[model samples]
Target: MKRKISTLLTFLILSLLIIPSSLAHDDQAKHDADLMCVFWGDDKVSLSSEEKIAFKIIANAAAITIDQYSLNPNGRIKEGTFNEIQEGLKYFGLPELSINFNDIDLNIKVSNDGKNISPNTHRLYTHLGWNYKKHPNNDFWKKRKHVLIDSVNRLLFNSKKIFSWFPWASDVVYPPSEQCDAFCAIIYYVHIIGDHIAGDTADKLKNIEPLIHYTSMDTPGIIVELKEQLQIVFQEQKNSYTFFELDQKLSDLTISIEKNCDILGFIDTAEKCKKNQEHAEQLLQILSKHLPTLLKNESFFKSRFK
Candidate 1:
């Protein structure tokens, strides 16, 4: 017998928020799947560990309806129109119910004014296409309804750019800080991952050349690794890094940083304002702990490609 809607939905919500990779990893078919991890500098939620958990939970909840609406833009569901925002959310295979956008604890700001956030004082639900009659110019609603999911998703998950810990808001200007060094380190880590994924015969590492430039320019020699291993991943093409091997290599690299945070180049007072070393330490911790768990999840790995 099939599980009830509530049971199925709980699983979907949990998988989407808590462990996307874990569930995908269990699927043997997706074992060889490869997707580069996404990253971003601004337009992302960067905060402490506890804060991230809360952000993911609420963000996912708040965007559920949008995700569903985007997939089926032609019309409403079932025999009725989408009257409730919760109803739209439920269409995304969510078994439970509608979510309150107000509960999302985030610091998103308007791109233009930089003072306002969505789903909060903005009341995103009311603007959705469900209340089509409310809008005189229905094109705005039509466009928004179609791309709602991705607009939100990009703020959280971006594969095109390297992720950063730098605090950003539209209005706030950040001074030169250690976060730059930390970002440099992560870029090199991604570069090395790209090297292995590309293998020796191919010259695909060019994709990360920009990353390499930024890392070397920012911290100069921050990627402290054994010369032999460096050549293996970079110079040698025959030895391509498989996912498990890549995970092990990434683990080693992060652990190396934990052992020596100086690889982040934080001795100088130039960018020495705040949290550079401390943030680098945090990155090492994330790589050592969080990254390993994420890599092990086959589904999450593939989603990176998607």
Candidate 2:
């Protein structure tokens, strides 16, 4: 009986030690999966310049609508605000959004003195642990406020259409007839930027710096290196390289960066390195598939880098 009790206690101790580690692994895996979904969604969508401008206009209008509602004592979007969105949608020939101002119940309130208020559209502020009264005009809040506005625009205008379940299929399908708009692009952009910004200042800079360098035309670093590499690979192969070979070369470059580059200094753990590798692989595949066409538009392609 004494031996059995001792064994039982040992087993319990072992379980306690193992369970949290297993749970932590599971949590990390889920987080990576969510990130991958965002990445994949962004990669598959393409938007034209005009559509991009229209989306911006519509997004700005939506922000105005939210601000108007927040300021209104009645907690309703103004008729003018609603009309502006409709007009923008019609002008762009985009499908009409089905929101009624009367139907929205955002559960916000204003103080009697008009100085204090319940949280309105910027719920992300609360999520980030930012006290509105304390950090109202800081750069951190401003950047995140833009993200919130874009998210709200997506929620009001595009989410229902994009996320609606297909009648014949169990899964949600973005309608094929509709163009992939700002909604598709912004979701992942927001997720990645939001995730980076959630970290400490140093870590945030480390994470976002690579992204900024890759996206900005004025920044002469990773993107320029990528473009040069792409040119070299295409020139050497003369359009004869197998997709597999091209993918492998690009993967090698990214892996090299992952292992040795200071650009990814924020990736401290093996799990983060693995996740970054996977994201790089996906991006490389996109470049590989579009290599021929992208090369053909040499001037346009070169314009994307320094």
TM-score of each: 0.22, 0.28
Q: Kindly list the per-residue Cα lDDT of model 1 for residues 30-111, writing each as its tens digit.
A: 2112111222212232554433332233233323222222112222211111122233233332222222232221223212
Per-candidate RMSD, Å: 19.3, 22.8
lDDT of 2 at 176: 24
Residue 66 miss distance in model 2 (angstroms)? 16
Clashing pairs in 1: 9-95, 24-299, 25-298, 38-159, 39-163, 40-163, 65-89, 200-237
Give me candidate 2's TM-score against the actual structure. 0.28
Candidate 1 regions with alpha-carbon error over 4 angstroms: 1-88, 96-99, 105-243, 259-306
Question: What digit string (tens of lDDT, one per residue) describes model 2 on residues 182-230?
Answer: 2222222333333332333332323122432333333323323444444
Clashes of 1: 8
